[model samples]
Each structure stands twice: as C-alpha cells, then as structure tokens.
Target: MLERQSTVGSAPIGSFVALGDSFTEGLGDEAPDGALLGWADRLADLLARRSPVPFRYANLAVRGRLIDEILEEQVPQVAELTPDLVSFCAGGNDILRLGSSVDRIAERFEEAVVELSSHAKTVLVFTGFDPRGTPVLRRLRGKIATYTAHIHAIADRHGCLVVDLWSMKALQHPRAWSDDRLHLSSEGHRQVALRAAGVLGLRPTRSAPATHALQGRVRQPQRLDDLRWAKEHFLPWLGQHLLGRASDEVLEPKRPQLLPL
Candidate 1:
C-alpha cells in the first residue's frame, strides 16, 4: 500500500486521486506548505469550493514519471485509495524521454486508463499544452493530436472524462506558461481551474455556502463548445488590452526572426 503523506484531514470523506508527473506535482509555484501548487492543487482547491461532499485529494505524482513507470508504480496504489474523481496527467516525460511514438505511448496510456476505470467513478485525464501555439515546447506538444485522440477514445471506452488541456492550451497564447516553458503561472492555474470546474459542472468561484449555491453545476450541464477559443482568443486579447504590450511582450513571441534567418 502506498502510504498517504500530507493528508488533508480537514477535507471531507470523499477522495480524489491524481496519478501523473511533475505537472501534477505543481513544479513551478510554491504552496503554503512549501510544495509547488500545480494544476492539480488548483483544481482541488476549486473543486473543494463546490463539492457537496467533503473532498480528500491524494497527489500520487512524482517528478520525471514515464508512462511505463507510472503503470508499474502508481496503478496498484489507486485501488487502495478508491477515489471518487481520479485525474491522470502523464505522457510528458514519456514523450520527452522515450521519444515520441504515437503507438507505443498510446498503448501504455490505454492500459493505464483501463486499469484505472475499474477503481474510480470518473477518471479525468489531464494533458499538456497545445503545440500550435507554443513553438518552443515542441517535446510537450509533439504528435499531440494523435496522442489526445487515443486518449479521447480511451476515455470514451471506459466512460471517463478526458480534460483536454491541449485543446485548452491551443486557445491560449505562449505567455500563459512560466519561464521554464512548461508549467503554468498563478493566473494560468486559475484559468485551468475554472475550465476544470466547467468540466465537472461546478462554478468557477470559490467555495460557497450550500443554499445560495447553484445546483446541477455539472450534472447534465451544456458542454463548453469553444473553450479553446475562450482561452486563446478571449483571454489573450483581453490580456493584450488590459496589460498592454507588456502582456504581448510577456506572452507573444519576442524574436520571431532571429539567428541565421
């Protein structure tokens, strides 16, 4: 059994298990406890706000995790947690380390999802940025369409939800990412959390009181058709307008024509 550390005891009985890598570990920003507040943490914070039941989250992610490694190490421990909502954000390291092959990576990913479905109510699979927008993070988004397609199919087969971060990312400008060209900033985290809430059918706001809160936030809600546009077009344009060229200076390509060009 994988021993639980950093257990949020104040959290409700309900549990969420995150199985993935550094992104899941929140590698960039620091948390109150001195850990990085990755997307999972932000999502957890957002979900806690809207959860009707008390929520306990177990972030079972380590740095530099690969697909095969995750299958061997993380899968077994999932059965023990028996989470209500399961999130899996992997494949970055695998793609980075093992070389990008659509078939090989998808095979391992499919197997992981198949195993994970049996142990949870809904498995939310998280992925990285969209390649179309971020030219620098080629490793992160290479063969992304093919990869996400397989993931979409796998989620469909198992009745799980694939949170398409890639698609979300395509809609976003390059500036949303941090200096490392990988992880999200605080605003980026909030944007992702809001989208996650939309996916789970919860409101984007903080934890609210029971009565005044809206019901059926997720259950039978309309799917957000243009989340990519919302992120890419709306957010960036807004960012440009509000923050001025500074936002463009931060997010937009700084040196489009450089070097030997």
Candidate 2:
C-alpha cells in the first residue's frame, strides 16, 4: 500500500509541460468524453492546488511517438512555453521496435533531457516500469532495465528529478495496465501522479490507494483473450508499421498549449 496524506504543501511549481508518447498522453486512462486523462494531467491538478500562483499545464504527447520524434518535435516547444516544470517519459515505443538499440535510444533521450534541463526549472523523467510480471513484455525487461539505468545516470548528471517507475510495486498487478499490457490504467495513472508529486516534493491532498487489488481468477480461457488482443490491438499496430504510417501523424497533440487549469 502507498501512503500520501497531506494537502498541497509548499512545493513551488507553477507551470508544467509533459512530453513523450501514449503514456504521458494518458491513453488507457480514458475520460467520460472518450479522451485520455493520463498521469501528467493528474499531476498538474496536484501542482495547481499546491502552488501559490496560477498553475498552467500542457501535454504534447501523442500516441506511438518515438523518442527521436519527441526530441525533434516536442522538446523545441519548451522554450516557448517555458514552464517551470517539465516531465519527459519517452523511448518506450522505440524500444518496442525490432533492432532498436538501448544505448542509442538513451543517448537521444539524454539529449532531450539536456535541452529540457536548460529550459525548465525542474525537469522530471520516468524510468520504464518493470515488465517481468508481464508475459509478452518480459522478454524486453533486460532492455528496459538497461535504459532505466541510463535514465537514472542522465537524471543525476543533468540535475533532474526521476519518477522511477521501474520500482513501483503496484504496477505489477493486472489492473495497472490496459488490455494491451503496454499502457497504464486509470489507477496506474493515479499511482504515477502520486509518485511524481512526491518526486517534486509536493504533498497529496488525500490518502494513497493500495498498490495491489484482489482480482479473482478469471473463468474465461486464456487463449481466447490472447487471440482477441492480437486481433484487436496488436495486428492494427503492426499494420501501421508495415504500411509506414504513424498513428498520430494526422492527429494533433491532445493539449497543444500550456493553459490554466
């Protein structure tokens, strides 16, 4: 169980900008209007409550974005928004591809970090969550671990805070992820928000929820679920790559501008 039992304290964040791909965009954590309200938004709400001045936020995350793309497209926006805080969680999509090099990805990631550190007062980065408990993603756990180590080293070198998702125990549970086993769920997003707030030295206004929940054994056949996931989620994603079409190519960022909450 996690514990966060304090109102928005004296943490001095005023504006924040989030950059990366689906996770930062809140893909699995859908809102009522069919929009995703992922962790960055949750953390922004917390910051808004804690800060003495008006807090503004922008999320430039688009689904299926690569780290290089973020560096090329998103990082430049930091100079304009000039938010006091910036969160960078990328390279997962890059890692998922075949022939992807962890070292190369981390190098590009660090480049963005260097640029971000110069622009924002507080630069925040997230390590990839542990995937050992996941069947499909576990094979890439080694790569994830390697990248995470680089993330920590980069954070240390650049004087940035980290939201070490690799160590979050609660995310191991099924509920923390969506059906695809890639993105985090709503509760997972909440957990991430709580962790990010802690990293920024902010206090939550409420208690933290238990990391694990009791999800009774499923009666449905496992093979059926796997087939469905492959058909509904995996195939289309793979098809996009085969056709050289990026999912977010036509879509604009969910929150393009930094605005008051």
Candidate 3:
C-alpha cells in the first residue's frame, strides 16, 4: 500500500488547480447546466466548504490532452498560479494509443510532476484504472497496468499523494463508466472525489454514498449494447486518431481563471 503524506492533513488548502485530459476535464460527470463536473471540480467544492478562508480554484484540463501537451501547455501556467494544491491526472490518452512507449511517457510525466511539485505546496497524481471491464478498452489493460505502475513510482519519488484508481474495485463495474467506456460516469466521479478528499483529510460538506450501492447489480453488456457503443463512440474516436485530430482541439478550458467557489 502507498503511504499517505504527512503534509496532506497538516493544513487547509487556500487555492487549487487541476491539470489533465478528459478524465480530469469531467466528461461523463455532466451537470444539469450541461457543464462537466469531473472529480477535480467536486474536490474543489469540498475544499471550499471545509476551508476556513476563501478558496480559489482553476481547472486547466482539456479533453484528449497528451502528457507532453500538458507539460508544455498547462504546467507553466499552473506554476504561475502557484496554488496551494494541484491535482494532475494525465497520460492515459497516450497509453491508449497504438505503438506508444510507456517508458518515454513516464519520463515526461515525471518531469511534469517534478516541476509542478516545485511550484505547489501539494501535488496530487492518479493512477489509471484497469480498462478490462470495457469491451473496446479491455485490450489496453496490460498497457494501463504498466503505466499505472510508473505513475506510482513517480509520485513516490516526488513525495506527491497518489490516488490508486487501479485498485478501486467499485470502478470495475460497467455502470461506473460512461457510454464511451473510457471516462467515468457521474457516480464514478463522485466516488473519486470522495476518495481524494479522504486522502487530503478533508471532510466534504455533504456525505458521499457508497459507490457499489449506487451502481446496484452489475449487468453484462449485450451484443447490441456493444455494437451501439462501437458505432456511436469507438468508430468516431478511431477516425479522429487516424486523421491526427482530437476531441478537445477546439474546446476551451471550463475554468481558465482562478476564482472563489
């Protein structure tokens, strides 16, 4: 088991900045207002409520961002913000791609973590979950495992807190995932936010219910369900990769500037 940092519970966070791709961008956790409410946002809300002072937050995560893209584009900006806390979850998009090198990705990922840790009082990193539950993403399970191991090592070396998504049994359920089979569902995001808060030793304003109870009985995907998913999400994603495009190429950051929640 990874040890929690002593500093995690030592102080209240005054500011927070999140960095990463679709998972961090809150894809499946859509708000009633049509905004994405990923785990990072939820965590920020929790921190805001617990904080004795005003809390400022910014989320620079854009979907489909690669590790290098986050390092080059978001890291400098995040460092400038100099927030008290930073949550970074990237490189899953790179590992899911064909012919990607886990070692090379890890090197870049570690570099970014080191840089971010230097700027922020606390840096949070996440391990990629096992994709074996998703039909299409199942093939990348081995790669995801390898990448997740690297993440653990990197986070340890930098003294950063790690949220081990790989071992979250509740996330293995199909219902915890979105129709895309890549991102987490709204409930999944909520559970993650709760887990993150626990790591940081912060009590949320509202209680988070058990993830397994919310999911109920696990149902296997039918043939029609798989076909529908492939037609609706997988094929378009494949075409985008083939053409060297990304879903977030034209999308903007949900919260570009830091503001009080």
lDDT (0 to 1) per candidate? 0.60, 0.82, 0.83
Q: Residue 109 error for model 1, in Å?
A: 0.8
Model with the higher lDDT, candidate 1 or 3: 3
What lDDT tens digits, residue by residue, belong to model 1 across residues 144-248? 767777888877887776677776632264344564445666556656655665666554345422312222232221235235545555455335433432431
Q: What's each prediction's clash count? A: 7, 0, 0
Lowest summed lDDT across 10 adjacent residues in model 2 is found at 1-10
How far out, in Å, is residue 207 in model 1?
16
Candidate 3, 95-136: lDDT as tens digits: 877789999999999999989988999999999897766777
TM-score of each: 0.68, 0.88, 0.91
Best by lDDT: 3
- Candidate number achieving the greatest TM-score relative to the actual structure: 3
List residue ranges in candidate 3 displaced over 4 A: 1-7, 203-207, 214-217, 246-249
